[model samples]
Target: MRAVAALARRSVRAGSGRFLVEGPQGVRELVRYAAPSVVDLYVTAAAAQRYAALVESASAAGVFVHSVSDEVLAAMADAETPQGMLAVAQQPEPTLADVLAASPRLLVFLQEVRDPGNLGTVIRAADASGADAVLVTDSSVDVFSPKVVRSTAGSLFHLPVVTGLDAEATLAEVASHGIRTLATEGEAALTLPHVDLAGRHCWVLGTEAQGLPDHLAAACAERVSIPIYGKAESLNLAMAATICLYASAAAQHGTQ
Candidate 1:
């Protein structure tokens, strides 16, 4: 129980270099990715009865399973309704250089993004779009926050995410890699679909209320906007990011 509580705290996660993954789907993803990395697995007796197959699979894979009290499991879970199972897995250290070395060179830089849900959704979209990685600036919320991790729906395990980058330093590093940086703005003359997104690039999306910082926007090789004819003042950051990523994916595949 102390171990479970420790895993829930960010400072402990950083010190231990591990994070918790809850729910059957999340645990399944961890198993599929690699079972040996899982430090500990916990499930209530009720959950074990409900998800016998999953429990069986975990046992077959050599994961340490603990059938704890339902109250204990509930206390460990971030969700209002606990899913009954959770695992502590090592968090891989990913860097900008490492991501650039990977395939698809296309990356997403999130600046000062406060909402974990939005960040997680953007990470999922980035992964689905075949992006090399997602970079979260230091001003942004912690990627390992429970809300963000749960919102990721386990996509976090499939993609490389680098956090704690200063805005200017991040831009400079990405630019040094010869990757074109595109900042999205509602007022930019160019629309996302109209831009050539096939080249190695990094798309920068800012906070919801305030858009990109002026210096950062100016650093971008191009400023692009999404076309909207409705009464909505602006698109949600996650929605804007998804549209831009897909547009880039389509352009890269020559389907645009």
Candidate 2:
């Protein structure tokens, strides 16, 4: 139980090549999408009953499903209030070559993004917007962290996320795939609507506080800014990323 709870720590997850998936939503998706990676599933009796279909799916995948007491579930979960279900799953290994090989039309490149919630929200938005993949630099937060995985709300398992990349080299490689790279900046002369998003492109986003550094912005083919109409100081990083991704989605689908 102590070892299971220790999975919440990044060092433990890294060393073990495993991470915890909490709640019904995350566990359900993990079973449905990445079932082969599931190692052990722990659930309370009530959760097993409530999420019977889910448990059945996990069992069918040959996952070890353990029904433990509520106290045990609490000890194994990372959430303040245990969601009654949790799972230990192996981490996925995706590469940049894999992403490029898919001929991705639209993509997102996150540079040094530090906030776990913001990173998770951006990943969820990318999935919702039909992004081919999410390329994350090593400077960013661990996408497999409990906060990030939970915040993704199961979108984490929906799409491919290639991590541990060098920011500049990644941008160049994606560009080599014939995808235009657009940096999201507050002061860019080009606004969102003016940019041609109907074609293959990648949106490069920055950190929560500092945003993209000048050199990273220069590396991209273009820079864009999301206009603020109201008195608000600025848009949140996740909200900005959502707007950017959805814009490309709309353009690609001819809905814009």
Off by over 4 Å in 1: 254-256
- Candidate with best TM-score: 2
Model 1 poorest ten-residue lDDT run: 96-105
Cα lDDT tens digits for candidate 2, 43-124: 9999999989999989999999999999999988889765799999999988999999989999999998899999999999
Off by over 4 Å in 2: none
| Model 1 pairs in collision | none
Instruction: Write one digit per residue (lDDT tens) for candidate 1, span 86-203.
Output: 8878886788778876644688999889988899899999989988889998788878877788888878878889988888888887888789999998899998768988799999
Q: Return the TM-score for each candidate structure.
A: 0.93, 0.98
